[model samples]
Target: MAHHPITHGRAGLNRRTILATGLLGTMAGFTHRPAAASETPPFRYEVTRSDTEWKARLTPAEYRILREGGTELPASSPLWQEDRDGTYCCRGCDLLIYSAAWKVSVPKGWAFFRHSERDAVLTGIDGPVPSYGMSPDDDTTMIEAHCRRCGSHLGHVLLVEGSVLHCINGTSLRFTPA
Candidate 1:
């Protein structure tokens, strides 16, 4: 007896069906995959030899975040709602981060679209991970902010959808009136 193949209107595992099923499985696998353990934590400031001297120069909020592990109140930062022609400098070191002309308002609290070329505020990944764990549904760009002078925690660099990362709410941040 010969084995007859089932003829059901283009049956016997079509290429399109196989590819579709494989793609679906891959998407499902990725969708339910576990997230990584690396997560960005809240902004915490560290001290240096000159930190003591800088602390004397900063305000209470600046000291709390740049020197000690602290977070500034949301919408409480004057820079968040600032609409002036000035620069945003490090509260701990007075290094310019944002230019008086580059500041702009965005949704993620106080948002700045540009940074000064000589500004010291920048992102570093070698720092410790934050307390929160990575979320599978969230983006995976870890940003670390440090003082330009003492390398203290001014706050965090939030990665926006575009190539823009807003550095906001760090305790070591201060705005200078131009």
Candidate 2:
């Protein structure tokens, strides 16, 4: 008896070859591609300042969080313990962003708020930015909240327990008693 190779019809492709080609094509379709740059212009804020002016106006920690988009260590800011009736303002421009009524206590250690004052913040998708305490290889995306007036980095908007949480960095805010 003669042994014969099993082949699919006209192309003479074997079962193993067809399966491997199909898997390779499927994997190629799933490969990650960086998003294309938007054609629209960048947003212009109500207040603008030079880098030198911003550095001079803000403290080292405040500058890091507000200008450089850096995150403070969890529970490191005194604002986390602030429970007084007051308003939270942007450390960069002193613009009121969050009201005391919107504040909520959460286990995340950051100053969590149910929401910001209307039109106080501008939110956009943060795509794996390493300056925001994410690793360079991290692919996680987050909703970044910025002060609408000064365009300073305030914090991130996250969903927690079916609620929208404005998880702000305390250093990015200045609390004023009402």
Candidate 3:
């Protein structure tokens, strides 16, 4: 009697078992791992406010985007159509974040700027938490911009057309004519 290579001497370990084990092992390797505690110290901004105070000070839309990291509807903000000499300040803490000089016309319907005032915004990687079972190698991460002084959620920093764009939420800003 000739024995098949895959069915070795009736040992009961067959190709299906080997393949299923390999598949499960590979899946286990990709299972989500809880994030370790952050090693870096948390940032302390120049301005801080209580949640109640922030909600009281900001409009519902402003609070949603500035405090909750939510996004405004595209083209909904009149600031997207604003073309004037002015500065844009954080609505949360009145901190200067962008300049009209840096503003650019982009079809994205959000307030787009070529850059921001020096040190006016801090950027960090924002994305879905890995604990949500997202793949570690996923490219869903985005560069989130925040108010340097108040640490409010501003928008995102993106590379557009070989230029660094500070794509900001107009609802999160208060425009001041320069």
Candidate 4:
């Protein structure tokens, strides 16, 4: 057989060329992963300013948590040790959620209960996730809350075992202290 190379410099492609192309695509994906994965843009919770005006309605701790996105220290919430008769309402908008008869202690300072009263509170939806504990766990529920009129992020809710749910402080709600 005779070789015909008069018209071209190269005869055929090689394995290295194909491997290099694939490697370049993989590199591109790796470079962009972090930028996409860690970016959570900020969102507005409510239209009105509920913090300053409502200071008098909450204790110092509730004001810090509900107005500043602060978390109450474990075993420090008044609700953890409270034994009273009243409903818990948002200090910001006074939207009621829990009745005094429903509070339960689970070693976490905040209180847990079965559910919220209809028309007394609103829940925002959380979508599906891929990893362990990425979404709310079987004992936890996640929801964005707001006054029906104000759209505030009152706090997050986590459903617990035996149908109990915890409404943690989220820098936008307060109890009436009664």
Candidate 5:
């Protein structure tokens, strides 16, 4: 029996190779347009802007965590200590997503909210992000929250006591006085 480089025992596509190819193609579908001021990519969100505009609007730190999906150090957000009456809006699109009244302090070092405005936030099945606190098992997945208007990466929603806990990053939010 001779084995070819492209195939294994049966000389056909292997499960691993097919799965890998499918995974790569699926991941590629999530790619956004290039980072430039011109050439606005079509987005479902009402608010759309060029990468350059986003960069100019956001600070370097905010750009990384919000646009690039980078995580901030735990307990490093000034909003961590925020205990005022206000609304929490998306730093990317100024969309009012969370209410200050729903803020809950947890030891996890991120802003925890019990709820958000009905239409202000959207959710999706989070992809494989190492630090996203999702179990590797497909049965136990993580839910990601975002600004419905701008598609900004807010954070993940974890289930606690059978209730939803929106664990949002402080860098992804801005507070406004009520």
Candidate 6:
């Protein structure tokens, strides 16, 4: 038995197991998880891979956040504040999209770039109307951006404050020094 604050008249929760499951639950990949797939809107990418291949190619967290359509916790990625001279590319495939010079530090808690190479990434709806998760008030509708070449979920793009916020997941990007 362990002390946990989250309670709803549940009994006999193994501490480690519960904690691990709770943590994993917060993470979803770019693709739908089995639990959420039924509610997920139809989407397709030219590039397809078997679940086994994607699992093997990505880390557990990456697969969850990229393929399972899970989200990393806010402020969890160091790249949110990363300002350096380099190129930011897709983690799933080494395709350069944004330059370091245009990246901005926004309070959104993800990598915010002013723009990207138009041809390097594909922009599309992440879901149906009210396309964002939960409520439009909490998670507003935004366009999802993925690797045009690999079809890997990068993050999202939206117009905010007269600038296009290329809010990318840290797990979805790899930085290369110029």
Q: Name the 10 consecutive residues with the lowest summed lDDT in model 5.
A: 1-10
Model 3 worst lDDT window (10 residues): 1-10
RMSD of model 3, in Å? Answer: 14.5
| Alpha-carbon RMSD, each predicted model | 16.6, 14.3, 14.5, 15.5, 12.5, 17.3
- Candidate 3's C-alpha runs over 4 A off are 1-42, 128-137
Instruction: Write candidate 5's Cα lDDT for 8-55 as tens digits.
Output: 433245446657677656655766735332333545679888899999
Better of 1 and 5 by TM-score: 5
Q: Rate the local accuracy (lDDT) of all candidates.
A: 0.59, 0.83, 0.82, 0.55, 0.80, 0.76
lDDT of 6 by residue, 1-178 (tens): 1333443133235435657677545553425534322334555655678889988989999988777666788889888888888998877767787889888888878888888876888887766657235666535456888888678888888877788788889988888877
User: Model 5 Cα RMSD, Å?
Assistant: 12.5
Score every model by TM-score: 0.54, 0.69, 0.70, 0.49, 0.67, 0.64
TM-score of 5: 0.67
Point out where model 2 deviates above 4 Å: 1-42, 128-139
Better of 4 and 6 by TM-score: 6
Best by lDDT: 2
> Which pairs clash in the backbone of model 4?
65-171, 66-171, 66-172, 67-171, 91-174, 139-159, 140-159, 141-158, 141-159
lDDT of 1 by residue, 1-178 (tens): 1223443323335436757677656564555554322223544444355656866777776677776646677776666777778777766556666676876576556545455446466566534545455554234445756665666665566656665555566344566778
lDDT of 3: 0.82
Task: State the displacement of the C-alpha of residue 142, model 2, in Å, after optimal TM-score superposition.
Answer: 0.3
**Against the correct fold, how does model 3 do in TM-score?**
0.70
Model 2 per-residue lDDT tens digits across residues 1-178: 1223332232245335657677656555754744223323566898999999999998888888999889999999988878899999998888989998889988777999998998999987787554555565444778899999999999998988889899999999999988
- Residue 147, model 4, lDDT: 54
In the range 6-57, model 3's lDDT, one tens digit per residue, is: 4353334533675767765655575475432332346689999999999899
Overall local distance difference test of candidate 2 = 0.83
Which predicted model would earn the best TM-score?
3
